[model samples]
Target: MSHLLDNLTVHPDCRHFRGDLPCRPNKTHGYVCESCPVYAPVTSRVLIIKLGAIGDVIRTTPLLRRLRQERPGCFITWLTHTPAILPQAEVDEILKFDFASALQLQARQFDVVINLDKEKEACALLNTISAKEKFGYALRPHDGVAWPQNQLAEHKFLTGLFDQVSQANTMPYVQEIFELCGFDFRGEEYVFDTHEDKGFNWNQLPSSGPRIGLNTGCGDRWTTRLWSDEKWISLITQLQQAGYSPVLLGGEAEDARNRVLHATTGAAYLGTFPLPQFINLMHQMDAIVTQVTMAMHISIALRKPTILMNNIFNSHEFDLYGRGQIVGPNRECVCFYRGTCQLGTSCMEDLPAEKVLQAVAATLPAATILR
Candidate 1:
């Protein structure tokens, strides 16, 4: 068996694995036995390719859970830019996207390759990988353009470009992605492994009424989705008046903006923490009001009731697990994916504070709502 070690892919970070070797290595350092620093041939392997929009990466992790369930102990490698967002227990190895990682992945053999991304770059990468079976979106013959790899993916794939098609499609995002991988979407919850050292002193927050989180930014990529600060201020004031503690949430880009919101509205500004601490912070919220941002996914993953503010994207695409409500403008969205709306009045601004407030109340647990 030792003689066969030389034939396996070697890595400096792994211990040699034996067929029956107790796998004594730190399981967190879950390198494949065949690909570990020391080598041994492993039977089955799976690779998942879904990159960008950290929120999408987090939500797609249900597939990881299903993958592990289908092939227990099989080596699973996930390729993503936001590795920290993934639960450590899901995949054995996480390959962050890059030239070196891409080369290494293309060299490996896998039983299944799942690429859920629609971007041309991810599509091209999927085309280069070797796998016995491929699912999800793949690169077409035309310059690495994206196309559905299987019939299951065709529904959402066809709707990807057209507004009416997407509006008409009722399949949830997770269900569609799962079907793409030849798996069933079984209302499987998002798995986010919490670290032991990720202890946040919950006492630091005010021991007040039901704490609600308000995620301020919609991200620069989709400026058309932004609700004005004035609206947020109004909502904050209303939350405060109604006895619900409002906490503002955002990344570093929103520091100054949050400070202004905090100063004017007196909403709690806990400031942004790293991914782990941020997760802990969100756990403290009873309910959350957010745009289609990473925080929304985190809120859903944590099982907190969420009020999703949507404008440009298809409402049918979201699967909130009956834990949330979608609040969009009263008018239909003409501009689909564009960052800025060319219309006279931004649809996001048209979304009345009362509508958002109503959604927030609806998602909150009956006990949490003061009224």
Candidate 2:
């Protein structure tokens, strides 16, 4: 009876908790652990280490949902730099990585530790942590280098150095992420706690129809994915003529660019807001037209019909959960995994504005003015 508590991580909700009321294999009670109320959870303290870009951090939440289902009341502590977009309800605690947090993590204990980031620092940190089961990226120890801890992780790990390997891969990011963590991807939806901005309301606007979001900026790292200012103006004008209200969406860097596009095209510019507020703004759109960026992932998580344009990144890299299309360039992408186009002109220029308008019309809510 004492061994029961020692061997299994018990759930607080179990009715027969003590040795006195131990679960029985009698005719009245099912002997199986799956149906038994007192069936102990296998996992307790789970640590998830994923740090970096807000988009990657946001998309990684689906793994939380899957992990929660496997073990009841399992306390999860996630390490990340961007906590703004993460859903608070899913994770028990969030440890923002620093020297103190690193030291704390090295000292603490976890039943399962999953480190998804391949950065040497992250891998080195994982090597120092104490856990019964460790998965994903690991350190080489002597030289302080990173490598895959398991076979599943090897597939995604190889994509970093080899272009041909990445091109040959058909696995979606979430699927590979889950595999790295030693779980199957079940088409889990992204978990996001979209906090609304107090006064930013689109309903007060003078215009009509369904509000379509035009994500006008790609991040600085992926400059090749950006569409020209002229193309954005053209798309906004076309959207207006087609009876769809276009809303320009972006961060601080995009404010000036968005202003120019808004003034020239008469598109509504929702000024730069915090990540949470930005999510609130995105939620108001009937559908979102975006490049391969964070907003696109956010729109997909919100279940808003998304129209995504891409050229550089692998088409299979995104799942979009059957809610969007991966519109690519007409010609073969000359640059892969590169920030700037070596050919002088970006391949994203080849994406026609007419094609985008058609997707907007097809996906727009019935409230929009029909063509």
User: What lDDT tens digits, residue by residue, belong to model 2 across residues 25-71?
Assistant: 42357444445654544348789899877788878889989988986
Let me know the TM-score candidate 1 reaches against the reference structure.
0.86
Superposed model 1: Cα runs more than 4 Å off: 1-43, 365-371
Could you tell me how far off, in angstroms, the CA of residue 319 lies in candidate 1 after the best superposition?
Answer: 1.1
| Residue 164 lDDT (model 1) | 75
Total colliding residue pairs, candidate 1: 1
TM-score, per-candidate, Cα-based: 0.86, 0.86
RMSD of each candidate relative to the true structure: 4.9, 7.4
lDDT of each: 0.80, 0.81
Model 2 regions more than 4 Å off: 1-43, 196-207, 365-371
